[model samples]
Target: KQDSVVEDISAGCGVINFKVNRKLLVQEDVKFGLTSELFNTLKRGTTLVEYSSPNIAKKFHAGHLRSTIIGNFIANLKQSLGNNVIRMNYLGDWGMQFGLLGAGFGQFGCQEKLKQNPLQHLFEVYVQVNKEAEHNEDMKQAARDFFRQLEQHESEAVSLWQQFREITVDEYQHIYKRLGVHFDIYSGESFHQDQAQEVVQQLQSQGLLKTSEKGTGVVDLSPAGDMSSVCTVLRSDGTTLYITRDLAAAIDRKAKYHFDEMIYVTDKSQENHFHQLFHILLAMGHSWADRCKHVPFGLVRGMKTRSGEVVFLEDVLDEARARMLHNMSQSKTTKEMDNTEDTAEKVGISALIVQDFKGPLLSDYTFDWDRMLQAQGDTGVFLQYTHARLCRSVLLKITKLYLAGGVSIFALCDLYSYDEVLYQSAQDLQPKHLVNFLLKLCHLIASAHRELPVKGSSQVVAQVGRLILVDSLAFNIQLYTVPLCTKHKLI
Candidate 1:
């Protein structure tokens, strides 16, 4: 029997290799540019992705890095598959922590220090107040009073909280710009605080709200219904808890966006929180809760600098850029490029993204600057290097081939596997598959570049070589255009 797709099948060394018809592969590549077919196969719909929800009045920590990049990748992937994506940053703006900060500011804050360095000043105030509150009864009462004033919408307390929020957001925008990340909405726990009361009322009306002996509002979640597993919704003081606000936010989002799906990206520590959230939503008769998902990732241990453990995300970014610049300076092939700092920054970010994405999302990994910044091996620096080398060596020839209306059969074979990886990535919501695929493609293209020299080849052979290079370049360009690689600035 003859196969149209598989040109030849041979067995070797405990493996069977099936060689695809190159001409057909090139024809497909020419017709669809490697991903159009897969994109067409997907069902387009609106997707709401909530991620990078850092608390206000605090520095963006390295722990948030995983959520930021992972959520960005999911949004980018969904959008690439023709889904309408809403990127949301659900900020932690309202909480008891704010109460302490507010009281601390009143006692020990400096306006000049705040103006000079907002996050650092706010952080110091928070730390100092927490330490004092440990032994000082007056400090504890002050924090409670300040929080009560905020809850009551007192003008003075409201004004101070708003200023802190504004300053934090302004500073965060600058850092987000550096990371190439953005959000369509900057919502916070405060946004749904009022709605949370309505949620409690609904829970009461539905007979789902139960009062514990301690007078806190909770929902029984255990199978035995013996109050073994409970989800708390309100405090004894009647203030809404985190889950209460989350329920309100979910209901509000469904009414507003009518999305086909919603994804929450957070650390694995909050797995039970989201679990109870969705379960309670289902119990509340919001069937749309079925479409909601929680994508949890593991921690990045040892994410620190020589100075100390990293508290601010800016510190990590600066460290990566500085380390990358130093490494570049040591390289003999390093040439002066325009915006060298910008290039280094982008590449350093790529290193961070790739290191985070190269393994299973639920598996914690240690961060090593020396390992990730290496110019060789399975690092992002190597990925960028490959792209640069291909661009410098064969971009002009690839352009000529494109103008001639010819597709590269030489590289189509390597690209054929991309669609499978992409489809798997979308289905599983895992980026490791895509990362590994790109790394393998880089190795294959590098090998092809070495073996297939175009400088002295026949016209047909040279055209084939150029086409191969162009396919790789085109694939990379398409990748970077998407938010995933775009954030990394791989091109």
Candidate 2:
């Protein structure tokens, strides 16, 4: 009886024979494992994610791009799992780099250009000043003096630095909008400067801090009695280093948010830095330091735009949007939409993200735009294209089904096939699993749409069954894609 029922309603009058539970096909949350019971029992808590920590007055490079999207993905995943996630962009807004930039700005910086093109002008000034400082001791001294003034909170120095930070942040926020990323907090090394000194003092009081032969303050992190590894918290001149600032920031975040876990997303190059950081915190008697994690990713080579090698995050976003638009214009399958530009932007970004995420996070890969944006294959464009195709197919049939009342849409689908794939995708956080499943679902959907007679005077019950299937597919697809889009405010 079950076999006969499957054959009767299967696509193309028994060409695709499969069985499905009617109730399971209609209940999306159950199919996706996001039921209320699961949430009620899950142990969810606060999580702070720090990512895309771009340096102030510097280019928001491709490395930061990786951090931004990866962090966003992590944040989205944690939230979906019921965790209270805080998205943070820890800007590198302090240190000697600022001293160089400050001194350079005083010499070659223009108020007009700085106001007009803040990052570019500042980068140019930094480059120029760096070259001059290498040959001129006077220029070097000026950098030191300017940095000293900044540390001392001199009005003029602080005001200039503040302007640079504000302008750069404003620019980054706009660009992050294009990539669909946002931050709850924009904390930085500067925010921890005072706290860093206090941390040093605390370490001193606790007898954990010791002076090295070079006059720098070091913390012993070795497991053995002999010091195998030491973290340098203070330089010879009493200035706090990057790790010191990080320690202060971590402590501050824990105290303020009381986050159960904190994750730092950066490149693999800084793996050692984080190792030392967590070690120092543990040595300082902060047991909660073990909850901290550093999620390191690999590099991308040959990412460029028409102008040249990509420098700013804006360039990468623009390049993706522009290339996608061009591809859409050339493709016969491209649909006419009121917001084609916006669609292209989403699709383009989707392609870039999928391409990067297709491999293991720790493996470096050469980026190729053409490969990423291809219409067919395991590319992001393919995912977006499939989604768009499914949307059109379902919407057209849905209108017909609505007109044909009392139809049983849930009856026609082989829900077991799609349900298993969706379940597995959700369980495996790797996006490729979801991607491959989506591709298979799209294939099955395309075949069903072609074979199923939904257009002319179809049985109302059959139409309803098809509608149930399409709605289920839409729900599942959005379950994965919506988070990416929502991060960028696309939905």
Candidate 3:
């Protein structure tokens, strides 16, 4: 066994490293998390991850899906290495749009439509109501009045919007559960509505807020915006801006959680907005301002069916599972070997996640089904196939033994045999290197298992040895299944 380099150094009083010379016992089916080796190397800190924020009554798109998975991976990694992690889902359940949804659902929204196609049908009604209001000033007043009613605690408007939001959340929860994701906080812009006013007061008191030429409250980001396009904090009608909501949200989270740091994950277009947000907080004297981060991803073209073509996140999962099922059906593998539907979801989702994470986060990517499912190359299929092979091999292992003194290298009547090439190849390879190797080894193992024979070893010893080998192989395959961090600290 090799000791990590840090094992010999004794520098800090609170922590000390010492070494013991002993056999390195292998644990069965163990998943690595917060190992002493990891904690020793990791610098201490806290982190916040904000992701998977689909707006109220809006279709959950690929971008939101991406944020959900990526932010999750980051939070998982940070927490695994002993950092305080805050997972925030900034749901977009607010704004004048809710007003439109409430108004439309009141008039022409159908019960069946709301049940079967909630987000889309509601969105349809919302778009129509907005268009109608834009052309018919009376419709505009109605929409405004609808929003005001909701704002002023009007029972009917509030009740409908609440139902819409609840149904949307429940539906999304089902989808997220299927996808193996969860959020710690569902902090929305609406949740910060009251906090936004206080933030405004703080800004006003700190002299960060100003009355712009247009009568809306502005944040004096003029110098920050490079002499043009200053940022807005409040509309002329006194409604808070999106950035204002974010400022209040950050403040609320920090005050409540006392996080060591926080991260906001969104697209690049919001870069300027988050910058102004952090600056406003810094001006308000939150020293943790330095800890806030906005992780931006690139544009995804053709994001809607109405826009000629688009990719839905659910569609992506469906395609991946379908393709996986098709491949399994074509394979000579028995149904007993793999569940077509269950394995389909696992393998499909793994493929999706692997593809999304293969490239740098800030880079744009084209979605291609074939590219993601290729079995002969780097892919989730390849990875899963590798895992399955390890499982089978562990289950298939046979122990070899010899008579007390008669066993020879090759002269025995029954000699345990291994593919010379495969055995030789596995020498310098670590466990991870074995996954793809297992793919190639499948045929070899199948043939070898049939042809090879055990020698004079008793069945008990042989069974025990074989079981131990299987456990070793399973442990190794598990190591491959774990995701690596951006810094490659662990896998």
**Candidate with best lDDT:** 1
**TM-score, prediction 1:** 0.91
TM-score of each: 0.91, 0.86, 0.75
Summarize candidate 3's per-residue lDDT along 273-347 as a digit string, tens digits: 888888778878987988887878775544332233433456556667888788777777534644568877777
**RMSD, each candidate, Å?**
3.9, 6.5, 9.5
Give the clash count for model 2.
5
Kindly indicate the candidate among 2 and 3 with the higher TM-score.
2
Cα RMSD of predicted structure 1: 3.9
Clash counts per candidate, in order, are 0, 5, 0
Please give the lDDT score at residue 184 for candidate 2. 99
- Which segments of model 2 are wrong by more than 4 Å? 1-42, 393-436, 450-460, 487-491
User: Better model by lDDT, 1 or 2?
Assistant: 1
Candidate 2 lands at a TM-score of: 0.86
Off-target runs (Cα >4 Å) in candidate 3 are: 1-46, 222-229, 301-312, 333-338, 396-473, 479-491
Q: For candidate 1, give the lDDT of residue 334.
A: 86
Off by over 4 Å in 1: 1-41, 396-405, 455-468, 471-483, 487-489
